[model samples]
Target: MPLILIIDDDPMIREMLITAFHQENYDVMGADNGKTALDIFRTEDVDVVITDIIMPDMEGIETIREFRKIKPDAKIIAFSGGGSLAPDGYLKIASSMGAQYTFQKPISIKVLSEAVKDLLGSCKKKL
Candidate 1:
C-alpha cells in the first residue's frame, strides 16, 4: 500500500483530505502543522505529501525544500487559498521548489486525485 502524508493547519482541511484519501483506500497520515509533517516524513515511508501553503512553524515551500534535502525522491503537492499570502505564482514557486504540482484552494477531490495519479504514474518506480 502507498503512504500519503497530509500537512495542514486547519483541522477541517486535514480531515477532509484524510477522508477523501481514506475513501480511495489509501494509507493516510495527518499532521496539523508543517513541523509534524516533516517529522512524519523523516520517520515514515511516505510515498507522497499533500501540504497546505500557509502553515505556522514551517510553510509549505520551506517544507518542500527540507523534504527534498532529506528525500530527493519524495513527491509533494502544495496547496493554498491565496488569502494573505502571495497574490499569484504560489503553484509556480512550489513547482520551482520541487513540488510535483500545486493546488489552489477549494480543490475538487476528483481533480486532486487525478493529479496525484498522474504524478505517481510518471514516476520511474511503481508503488
Candidate 2:
C-alpha cells in the first residue's frame, strides 16, 4: 500500500483527509504542523504528501523546499484556504517549489484522491 502524509493545522481537515485516504486503501499519517510532518517524512516511506499552505510552525512552502532537499523527486500536493496572500498566490509558490499538484480550500476529496492516484501512476512509469 502507498503511504500518504497529510499536514494541516486544522484537526478537522486532517481527520477528513485521513478518513478519505483510508477508504481509498492508502496508509495515511497526519501531522498538525510542518515541523512534525518533516520529522515523520524523514522516518517513513511516504509516497505522496498533502499539505496545507498556511500552517503554523514551518509553513507549507518551507516544508516543500525541505522535502525537495531530502527527496528531489518527492510527490507533493499543496492546498490553501488563503491567508495574507490569496490561496492562488501561495499555490503558485508551492508549484515553483516543486509541488506537483495544488488545490484551494474546501477541496473535493474525490479529486484529491484522483490526483494522488494519477501521481502514483506517473511515478510508476518513471520507475
Candidate 3:
C-alpha cells in the first residue's frame, strides 16, 4: 500500500484528510506541523505528501524544499487558503519548489483523492 503523509496545523483538516485517504485504502500519517511532518518523512516510507501552506514551526514551502533534498522524487500536493500572499501565489511558488499538485482551501475530498490516485499511478509507472 502507498503511504501518504498529511501535514496541517488544523486538527480538523488533518483528520479530514486522514479519513479521506483511509477510505481509499491508502495508509496515512498525520502531522500537526511541518517540523513533525519532516521528522516523519525522515523515518517513514512516505510515497506522497499533502501539506498545508501556512503551517507554523517550519511552513509548507520550506518543508517542500527540505523534502526535495531528502527525496528528490517526493510527490507533494500543497493546499492553502490566503496567507500573507494570495492562495494562488503561494500554491504557484509551491509548484515551482516541487509540489506536484495544488488545492485551494475548501477542497473537495473526492477531487483530492483522485489527484493523489493519479499522481501515485504516474509514480508507479516510472518505477
Candidate 4:
C-alpha cells in the first residue's frame, strides 16, 4: 500500500483525513507541524504529502520547498484556509514551488483520493 503523510495543526482535521485515507487502504501518518512532518519524511517512504499552508514551527510553503530539495519529484498536495491573504495566493506559491496539486479548505476526501491516485499513476508512468 502507498504511504501518505498529512501535515496539519488541527487535531480534528488530522484525524478526519487519517480516517478518510485509511478507508481507501492507504497507510497514513499525521504530523502537527511541518517540522515533525519533515522528520517523518526523512525516515519514511512517503509517496505523497498533503499539507496545510498555515502551520506552526514551519509553514507549508517552506515545507514544500524543502520537500522538493530532498526529493525533486515529491508528490505534494497543498491546502489552506487562507491566512491574512486569500487561499489562492498561498496555493499559487505552493504550485510554483513544486506542489502538484492545491485545494482550498473543506476539500472533499473523495476528490483528494482521486488526485492522489492520478499523481501516483503519473509518477509510475514516468518511472
Candidate 5:
C-alpha cells in the first residue's frame, strides 16, 4: 500500500485527512509540525505528502524544500488557510518550491483524494 504523510498544526485537520486516506486504503501518518513530519519522512517510504503551509516549527515551504533535497522527485501536495497573506499567495510559493498540487483551507476530501491518486499514478509511470 502507498504511504502518505500528513502535516498540519491543527489536530482536527490532521485526523480528518488521516481518516479519509485510511478509507481510501492508503497507509497514513500524521504530524503536528513539519519538523516531526520530516522525521517520519526520513524513516518511511512516503509516496505523497499533504502539508499545511503555515505550520509551526518549520512551515510548509521550508519542509517542501527539505523534501526536495532528500528526494528531488518527491510527490507533494500543499495547503494553507492563509497567514499574513491570502492562501493563494502561500500556495504559489509552495508550487515554486516543488509542490505538485496546492489547495486552500476547507478543501474537499474528494479533490484531495483525486490529487493523491494522480500523483501516485504519475509516480508509477515514472518507474
Candidate 6:
C-alpha cells in the first residue's frame, strides 16, 4: 500500500485523517507537529504528505520547503483551518513551492479520498 503522512497540531484533525486513510488501506503515519512529521519521513517511504499550515514548531510551510530539499519531487498537500492568521494566498504559495494541492479544513471524506487517490496515483506513475 502507498504510504501517507499526516501532520497537524490538532489531535482531532490528526485522528480524523488517520482513520480516513487507514480505512482506505494506506499505511498512515501521524505527527503532532512538523518536526515530528519530518522525522517520520526519514523512517518511511511516504508517498504523500497532508500537513497543516500552522503549528507550534517548525511550521508546515517550512517543513514542506525542507522536504523538497531532500526529496525535490515530493507529493504534498497543504491543508489548514486558517484559524485567523494567513499570509495572503498561502495555498497558492504552497502550490508554487511544490505542494500538489491545498485543501481547506472540514473536507468531506469522500472528497479527501478522491483527492488522495488522484495525488497518489499520479505520484505512483512518477515512481
Indicate the worst ten consecutive residues by lDDT in candidate 4.
118-127
Question: Which portions of model 1 show Cα errors greater than 4 Å?
Answer: 122-127
Per-candidate TM vs. native?
0.91, 0.96, 0.95, 0.95, 0.96, 0.89
* TM-score result, candidate 1: 0.91
Model 1, poorest ten-residue lDDT window? 82-91
Candidate 2 or 6, higher lDDT? Answer: 2
User: How do the residues 25-56 of candidate 6 rate in per-residue lDDT, one tens digit apiece?
Assistant: 88889998988988889878988888888789
Query: How many clashes in candidate 2?
Result: 0
Best-matching candidate per lDDT: 2
Across 1-127, the per-residue lDDT of candidate 2 in tens digits comes to 8899999999999999999999888899999999999999999999999999998889999999999999999999999999999899999999999999999999899899989988899665321
Kindly list the per-residue Cα lDDT of model 1 for residues 54-111, writing each as its tens digit.
8888888888999999998788988888756562477678889998878888878898
lDDT of 4 at 14: 92
Question: Over the full model, what C-alpha lDDT does candidate 5 score relative to the true structure?
Answer: 0.93
Q: What is the C-alpha lDDT of each candidate?
A: 0.84, 0.94, 0.91, 0.92, 0.93, 0.82
- TM for candidate 3 is 0.95
Ranking by lDDT: 2, 5, 4, 3, 1, 6
Model 4 lDDT tens row, 1-127:
8888999999999999999999888899999999999999999999999999999889999999999999999999999999988999999999999999999999889889888998889664321
Tens-digit per-residue lDDT, 52-107, candidate 5: 99988799999999999999999999999999999999999999999999999898
Q: What is the alpha-carbon lDDT for the whole of candidate 4? A: 0.92
Candidate 2, superposed: residue stretches over 4 Å from native: 124-127
lDDT of 1 at 27: 89
Stretches of candidate 3 exceeding 4 Å from the true structure: 125-127
Model 1 / residue 112 / CA error / Å? 0.8
